[model samples]
Target: MKLIHAINDLTATHKDLLGLSKQKTEALTNNKLDEFQALLLEEQKLIRQLEKQEKKRQEVVEAWNEEQEYSVDSLTITEILQRLDGEEQKMAEDAAITLTDTITELKRQEQLNKALLEESMKFVQLSMELVNPSIKSMNYGAASSDKLSGRSLFDSKA
Candidate 1:
């Protein structure tokens, strides 16, 4: 359905935007200038994928409309019915396959977007942990040691 296709496209766009925003936010917080640039490039790639899907969807819609408009002009009612039935069946099969493929692709994109979001969140958390002054204070012993050993400040308490 055209409505379904439109909805899917909109959903994909929304997810892509959300993922991109999360990535940008995480990059800023983490002070990872190189990662930030890479994220920007990835966002562009997602935009291009969305555009390509939209174009394919439009083509499907146009083909579907044209198929529906086609008429089988025949002198005999039987011949006309046969032709119409064949055309309808063919169109139905094609539409079904196209719709299924479109939905699958959309679902895959959604999953990818979700994964990207999760990765962004992880990056944000990692950045926060790295930059948080309190964390250093909490591991004061390690910070004080010139060797940068893994021992925590709490090690003495144990």
Candidate 2:
């Protein structure tokens, strides 16, 4: 029961994170830096909550293993499912599957956000370059004798 509760909490937190992931995509797409920053802070909070839930779940699983005379060092969710039966098993299975799907979608959305951010950065860089073009170095190959030296582009007398 405790294990079931923990999984449910974890899944709920992950679903919240997925919702934020979609909002982050929108914020990034619309170039809303403030919203993006706020979303990041909220995501951090949810991640911390998720970690706590996961720890609780692991502890419950370990305790269950100890009671069942099984190894407490490592156990997969599937193994946990095997130990459970009836409604508990069904609920846990469904929650686990939903959590997995949500996490997968979140990852895909995060990747898309990353690419959008990269493109935005590139756009900003190009814009800055256009506004303030860099001065090119005049140094030429040693083998080439043609040299403008320190001469200005236009005669100063003009």
RMSD of each: 13.2, 3.1
CA lDDT, every prediction? 0.60, 0.85
**Clash totals, every prediction:** 0, 0
lDDT of 1 by residue, 62-92 (tens): 5654666755332232332234456554554
lDDT, residue 115, model 2: 94
lDDT of 2 by residue, 1-158 (tens): 77778878887898899899999999998889999999999999999999888888888888888888986579899988998889989988988898888889888988998999999999999999888876543445543434545554574665
Worst 10 residues of 2 by lDDT: 137-146
Clashing pairs in 2: none
Top-lDDT candidate index: 2
